[model samples]
Target: MSEQMIEIQTKLYLYDLANLAKEHGFKADDNWEFSMANNAERISIQKNYFPTNVTKIVPEILLQVLNSVRTALKQSLAVKDAPDAQSIIADELNYLVAFNPKRPRT
Candidate 1:
């Protein structure tokens, strides 16, 4: 949970990474219906995709999760105390979304 360890250089660039993922989502036609779906519905349409411009909705979904956590903490009374929580969840989520398992870094 050490945010600095996840940091690139000294920029604390997790935000930049988040922003890039957001841009990718937007470019990928994130506004479409198929972009949002339930379990069965999603599996059904995995092959047939429209607005093929939308090649990266899954990342958008991860971004939404980060935003949702941010929103949750914003409304809470202890927002200042838990600043790193949102970033950590976002990082954990990116790890999960990107299928990055808990492997030792070389």
Candidate 2:
């Protein structure tokens, strides 16, 4: 995919995730950052507030967020618009889920 497409997809994914997080009772900050290294892009989702102690976000919420984004992406792709970029975003979301900090180790 082109750099422009990738950036657009990333923004879409972040927007979806942020909305999902807010719907799940989490505070999603508007301040998000992105960086590229080793030919890969990384996004940092910011939280409005931080807990003093270690907090483990439940995996269920993460799964819900992932599903929500996946569904939206599928719907967007159904219109035959930016299929490649949407697919990449979906794959990236899956990767996030697989390595989610909230998920239990198997």
Candidate 3:
């Protein structure tokens, strides 16, 4: 039996959408459409095309990911005030500091 194909959609913020376009080398006239709602823009992805084709550059993408992490951590810490979360965040920060991609390799 032949498998059926399904379509799906997802959304991203303008900043992230720009990065995605840049990473994919999409031209200015590329076929894309967007809509604005709740003070954010949204796009309809036809399928799971992004994950198969895109890879995240650390410098370009890490800041956004870290911002989200810190925001969530802030909210969680406010609600729970857990020492473990504080320690985990500290350790992660230190690890990021120690991770120098430009350092000479032995």
Candidate 4:
């Protein structure tokens, strides 16, 4: 179920499709019906296939995650400020510095 065989079959079908289309005096564009059909069928065949109940514990720091996202949304809505990654880091740094006990206000 690791998709090694599926990947090979996919390659075979690709070549088959190409050859068939060529025989009909037309080549397939990526945006062509054949392409779209293949793409659509792939979603049905392969998309939902996953392994069994391998219970992997994902440690989510939920409070931190939620607070970060909430703050980002608040800033975006209040000031139309879409937070970039660097700006978010800077904001976190600024927060730490402002609240730090060691840093005396001069």
Candidate achieving the largest TM-score: 2
Candidate whose lDDT is highest: 2
In terms of lDDT, the poorest run of 10 residues in model 1 is 95-104
Q: On residues 24-91, what C-alpha lDDT tens digit does candidate 1 reach at each position?
A: 45443233221223344344344343212122223323334433433432423233333243554444
TM-scores of all candidate predictions against the true structure: 0.19, 0.30, 0.24, 0.27
Show where candidate 3 strays beyond 4 Å. 1-12, 35-106
- Winner by lDDT between candidate 3 and candidate 2: 2
Candidate 3: residue pairs that collide: none
| lDDT against the true structure, each candidate | 0.32, 0.33, 0.28, 0.28
The residue-by-residue lDDT of candidate 3 on 45-104, one tens digit each, is 222124111212223232333334334323221323322434544433211111112222
| Candidate 2 Cα outliers beyond 4 Å, as residue runs | 27-106
Between candidates 1 and 3, the lDDT winner: 1
**Cα lDDT tens digits for candidate 2, 23-96:** 54543333322111111222222122221111122222333333344554443213333224344445443223
Model 2 error, position 8 (Å)? 1.3
TM-score result, candidate 4: 0.27
Poorest lDDT segment (10 consecutive residues) of candidate 3: 1-10
Could you tell me which residue pairs clash in candidate 2? none
Residue pairs clashing in model 4 are none
